[model samples]
Target: MRVYSKTLKEFLDAWPGKKRFGIYRFLPLFFLLGASLEFSMINWHVGEVNFYRTYKRRQARKIAEEILASREST
Candidate 1:
């Protein structure tokens, strides 16, 4: 049996458009993807709920609980 492994350079070299665009070719694709995701997260909502708002509330609750727990223990 034979095992083959490719380094980062070898892997990148195998990607399409590397000859003309180099590593910079992926930047716009990723940037647009991230922008679209952010736009959706901000604009698209499920009924009255928002993902970031819920996440922030949950994080705040956890921190408050931790603070109260520490105060009670002292």
Candidate 2:
């Protein structure tokens, strides 16, 4: 069982019994909160072209041009 995993079991054993149970009680809520955050932040593009990719490419080109101009001037 997960309770017997080396690290988790060792940690639970090292802590006092009440504190260990308190952590277990909040674990499910933490998992739910993490899942909700991941879902909300996901990038959704079912059909349209990826605009982020194009924007990053444009930014990179501009940076490269500036670097080349600086090297030529120096």
Candidate 3:
């Protein structure tokens, strides 16, 4: 596998494209998106919950209550 990867890298390096803008340039973005998706799926699988949505709702409610309390005080 290491050999395969080395050869693959070499091929990409020699590929016909501007060295500054080759397919390899987008590899990091692809890796980042892939890793993010992988972790997101794992979180959803383990918790069966959308934490971001729930957290947003919780925060919104908290802010609303604070505003209402301040208004009552005024």
The TM-scores, one per candidate, come to 0.67, 0.36, 0.39
15-55, model 1: which lDDT tens digit per residue?
68877887687898799999999988878889987888888
Candidate 3 wrongly placed segments (more than 4 Å) = 1-38, 41-49
* Better candidate number, 1 or 2, judged by lDDT: 1
Q: Taking the tens digit of each residue's C-alpha lDDT, what string does model 2 give over 1-74?
A: 36858888887567655454865865776899998876644554446535565678899999999999999999
| Candidate 3: residue 70 lDDT (0-100) | 100
Give model 1's TM-score versus the native structure.
0.67
lDDT of each: 0.83, 0.72, 0.74
Query: What does the lDDT read for residue 33 in candidate 3?
Result: 100
How much is the lDDT of residue 39 in candidate 2?
64
Residue 8 lDDT (model 1): 62
Error of 2 at 60 (Å): 0.3
TM-score for candidate 3, please give it: 0.39
Tens-place lDDT digits, model 3, residues 14-72: 65554777556767768999999977855774355576667778999999999999999
Ranking by lDDT: 1, 3, 2
Q: State the RMSD for candidate 2.
A: 11.5
Model 1 local distance difference test score: 0.83
